[model samples]
Target chain A: MERVLDMTIQEVRELLRKKEISSVELTGFYLERIKKYDGSLLTYLRVTEEEALEMARDADRRIGQGEDGPLLGIPLGIKDIFCTKGIETTCASRILEGFVPPYDATVIKKLKDRSFVHLGRLNMDEFAMGSSTENSAFQTTKNPWDLSRIPGGSSGGSASAVAAGLCAAALGTDTGGSIRQPASLCGAVGMKPTYGRVSRYGLIAFASSLDQVGPLTRSVSDCAVVMNAIAGYDPMDSTSIPQPVPDYTELLGRDIKGMKIGIPREYFIEGMDEDVKRAVRESLAVFEHQGASLVDISLPHTEYAVATYYVICTAEASSNLARYDGVKYGLRIDGKDIIDMYKKTRSKGFGKEVKRRIILGTYVLSSGYYDAYYRKAGKVRTLMRRDFDEAFKACDIIVTAVSPTTAFKTGEKIDDPLTMYLSDIFTIPMNLAGLPAMSVPCGFDGSGLPIGLQIIGRPLDEGRIMQAGYVIERERAVKKIPDTLR
Target chain B: MKITKDVVEYVAHLGRLELEHDEVELYTTQLDRILDYVDALNKLDTEGIEPTSHAVPLDSVMREDEVRDSIGVDSSIRNAPERKETFFKVPPIIEVEE
Candidate 1:
């Protein structure tokens, strides 16, 4: 029975088809695990036991009736950043502590339609600000691999839940590597689809242009199943691309023979932790053994990625976060006047990192500095995109490390904001280029911490990216549950 | 470049955040450090390049403005700390000098 917790989504589906397990039984099993193990993990902010059981029962009824979706009866842990109808979508901020959203995010709607049980909302960095879950105003989510160590975030809770077997899978948002970084640290498969590939209608805004909703699952194939459900046009999200979403599962076992994979030279340079380099190098060998040729490519503008990302993301964050003032919705601090009220509300509501970003964003967008900082960052972003565009011409997919290092201990870099920001060094470039990217667990460090290998695909080409990731994941044979978690 | 306390205060005001004296000092130093690190961008030559905003090329996606019934009103105000007559109540903001 415990082995069911370690099974992949496809395996669970197969078991259900064989009548070896029922949806109600699986949901109950996960719910029981959440009860027993969640106290130490702190992964879930709120568990929707009643709602989940009701949904699971409905899925069981559907299974009894011969109707099934790929995600039928699968339980998913949702990051609190996405609005779920009647569920508190806090973004792990006090401002929205008890606020229940009246609507569902487009992805949530799609998952519900597929009969995926809502396991619960997971914690995240307040407004998805920091790389570690310690930034979450509510509670810090510990890495399943090492309870004392930090779970890379702002999707820490989601990654931890999936890694700890608290849930079958989870959804996370990536605004500059939130999904992939945490996925890497927790040894789970995470994918950030091409920008505009998934709708952002119900996702709480945080650096709008770079923000994207993605999946955190146990395997690359499971990620494909989740992506198939969520990726499509949504009338509510204007930025959503009106393109046809292909059946991702169709390409699951497809051949990667003769695939031209790009290895970016800049990604393997100095400042990367030696363990990460070794793991990624070994993973590359697996691809070679699989008959995929690696081409050395250069993205010259890669050096400017982090700088451009901070400037542009902060500028957009400053604007999007402005809607949270005390008046219309969220937390409101009382003051003598409107100005004082706004100040008090925001000051009390936001964390230090959030405030810091807002100030930086406001400064960059201010009249005198707009052209120098904000506008200039935009121009550099163009060059960064061109770098990827040129690289993609020679290879079908680009490979790199997800983060410079694996998850650091909690409080290791919290006070030092620059060091914390540097954690996302390899990830920001893909967001700037609007390319689809995925992080697959490739190897473990000396301390037994997980390391992820990132795969970047051309715009709207998530199929090839997932294909490559699945191939690598299978060939590497590096899948191992962390001892601390078991 | 060293960020001054005055600049921090001014930026905080612009961002609608109220910072205590200690917070201002703290952020001033932190922001300065981050700015210095990111200032590596200034060394790059981007003289004639066009700024890129959206990652994928997308044009403006405008929609027709149409009137619709509002929903979620009950849940929107469910967490309000203070509500009177179904509206959030706050301190008066009328200017007294006028």
Candidate 2:
């Protein structure tokens, strides 16, 4: 029999329903795997072993009472960015080191209602700031595929845990490729739902307009199962749409014939690694073979995406993060007076990357430079969105490389911030456009590092990407178990 | 956008962050490069384009003005660094005359 840790959510759900395996047994099985492996990967900031077992026990009782939900007893990892009432939710920054939110994030509330087991907070880049997990205030999370390489961030820990089966699946937030980039690097499936598709009420703000919560799992189907539970409108989030939610799993395994997949010419530009290009191209070929037409399209504003993203994201971040003063929740370093207290608390609390972003954000929004910096970037952002509007007119979904290369060594680009930012060049545009995109394991490089292929769909059209990702996953049939775990 | 040390200090102050000398020096160079790189936005002619603060055009998000149950005082103050019986405590905002 396959190890319970390796099974998908559906497999576990079936086992629980049949009474062959209890929810506590399943939870204990994953807790053992996490205990045995998490120390080496640094995937979890804290493992809620007792909480998970307790939740599992409750789920088993519910099962006995004939209550069966899709995620009734599944164990899942949550990125530290979400506020889980009474549980530490740090965003992996020292400022929020001990913050136990007064309320659960909408997604957490929904999942808890369905009786999902919380496996504890996953580590991330401080304030969800960097491409690599190196920016985390705590320890760095290593890629399960290659221990020396990094798990991509700021959802790095979530991706790492799912890739190594430390948790059956995990929830991750993506502002700009945080979910997809790391999932690609770690050989797991990650999704970024449309903006406001999932509520942002209690999620730590990174780029409010672009920030979204999604899932990282071992298979595309598991991503759909998670989506059904988390995606919907919430009165708490003003930005959430009032559209009716659909069962995303209904679209899976359906024929994708005649589906037009757009291939943006800009994404295949120079400097993309040779192995990455070949792997993505090979994956593209699989779609063509399966009757989907590939249309070459252009997002002419691709080059401006990263620059615009940094400007707007930082500007919003500056405004959003201003509330972390010492008087309120979280860490405090006493100073002589109120002003000094604010300065001391923030300076000592935030990591270097968080500080840099705050400073840059403040500069753009500062009096002298607002027009030339922030406004100009916003106008260019409109153009970037239009580029997708025009491209989608020609195609239903877009296919692109998730990152320029596979995972890099831990300390490789931490010193060179621009180089590190460029690592997410291909994945940033989708977020700027506020679309739903996903990363699926395409293939492995010669060094055994995993590569990710991004599938982007129209706004609120997560179903298409999920459908397409499912086909590619089945066709490739790639079983990726990281060396460390094996 | 030349990010000088003085400018770094000014921005840090605006961000309410206290930085040491090395931080100012390091950030000046790093911010300079980042600002210079983003200057490419100047190349495009945004003559009449409207700026987009958000990707989706959300209408006014209004809710009913009715009182509802909140987390309440105790839960709200649970994570406060320093708090009194029912409120967060902060350094005195107004200095009393000596």
Candidate 3:
């Protein structure tokens, strides 16, 4: 055995095709890894061993019958934000601690139908609120690279699981920078498709218009394979685009000669960590060497992105999360009156961060202040979009550093919420523009923590983004295994 | 841009979350700091700009008014805290005091 844990999705599929590995054996191998190593990593909240084994057996049977899909028998770690039928989808919150959704998210259904084995549900920030898994109510997931450090989140568990080789790939939901930030911190490839590219049915809403689901995998090709399976219109999700799905793998290995890649000048400013800037610059050099042109473009509204994102996202989150009152579902408390019950249940059920956002959102969206704060923020959002529109007109794709620095120590900024919020400063703009973005490992910091390069694309143009990411991910040759894991 | 403890409590009430006295003071200071940072937007020249909600251009995507089977009210409300005869139960609004 060549250590199946080190193999990529493509290699695993190749092994399965040659009968060198059965799906059952592969699933068993990963499940054993999770059982053995996940105690320290805390990557998974629930492990469906029986379900995964049964699905793997079925995949072997399907392969025997000459019907193997791209993801056939592949094990995936699912973020708990997606609803899985008859399984607990907690979104890592106490309100729904024991609640099992009666339905499956569209992505889960698609993967299940294709015979992809389910490894388990990964942990996340409560309602996908924080950038670190430290906010998860059940337990905090540590970065596999350094147990003393934090895994960037709210998709931290998904990123860590794939990085640590607990699963071949994982699914994650990104509202702002949940997927990309975590992926960058953990040395994994995470993609957030253009808005409406993937169905949102059964995904618990964080900020309705901003939330999107995508993949966190070991490689860009694996991301494309998963996207192909999950990116299609679902009648259940009204926001899903009704466009024809493209063959993402078809564009792989394409030449990038004479392609224009824009490096936004505003992104590499004074505050960026020197090491991260150097890594990104070196990655850009590789692109230029590969016959691609790098143009300097300016998104003037870049400085305003974090502020715009928080106001708009918080305003929406306040409204969207209001559905969790005691009346419908989740936790409910006995009170003297309806108002008391609502207040008590919410107070006891929600965490400090969730409560803070709700309050801020409510204040912004209130009747008297709507025009001043909420509406004004919305206007700024339009200008932010216009900035990207102008930038894209000059370049085919935009590249930037995913985070200012690599993974930090576990308790570095947990007490200071604003410091934690700055972790996604570079990534919030893409969500504001509803553009496709991806993160790939570029290099490592002095302490050996991995750094990532982010590539952003035009709206609904994920094919080109992945194609470009594939080019860099291969050429960079930055496969850094964490010291803690090794 | 200074958020007072009173403002935090008021906002908490609007959000339907109850906070303790100590938390009220703590969050008041924290939210004030965040609000001050974000208050930079007040300086932007968005005088004639229209507020944009959705990023992509979209028109009405309404569906036909055809009757289909419901998602089953029973299953939907299966997890409700208080129910009575297949309907969710909540406290009555108006009190009749004699």
Which candidate gets the maximum lDDT versus the true structure?
A: 2
lDDT of 2 at A79: 94
Predicted structure 2, TM vs. truth = 0.99
How many residue pairs clash (N, CA or C atoms closer than 3 angstroms) in each of the candidate models, in the order given? 3, 0, 1
lDDT of 2: 0.91
Lowest lDDT 10-residue stretch of candidate 1 chain A: A477-486
All candidates: CA RMSD (Å): 1.8, 1.1, 1.5
All candidates' TM-scores? 0.96, 0.99, 0.97
Tell me the TM-score of chain B in each candidate: 0.72, 0.92, 0.89
List of clashing residue pairs for candidate 2: none
Task: Compute DockQ for each candidate against the true complex.
Answer: 0.65, 0.89, 0.77
lDDT tens digits, residue span A326-380, model 2 = 9888889998999999999999999999899999999999998999999999899
Q: Rank the candidates by lDDT, best first.
A: 2, 3, 1
Best DockQ among the predictions, by candidate number: 2
Query: Which structure is stronger by lDDT: 2 or 3?
Result: 2
Give stretches of model 2 more than 4 Å off. none
Chain A TM-score, each candidate: 0.98, 0.99, 0.98
Q: Which stretches of candidate 3 lie over 4 Å from their true place?
A: A480-486, B96-98
> Candidate 3's residue-wise lDDT over A394-444, tens digit each?
999999999998998887888888878877888898888788999998888
Show the lowest summed lDDT stretch of 10 residues, model 2 chain A.
Answer: A1-10
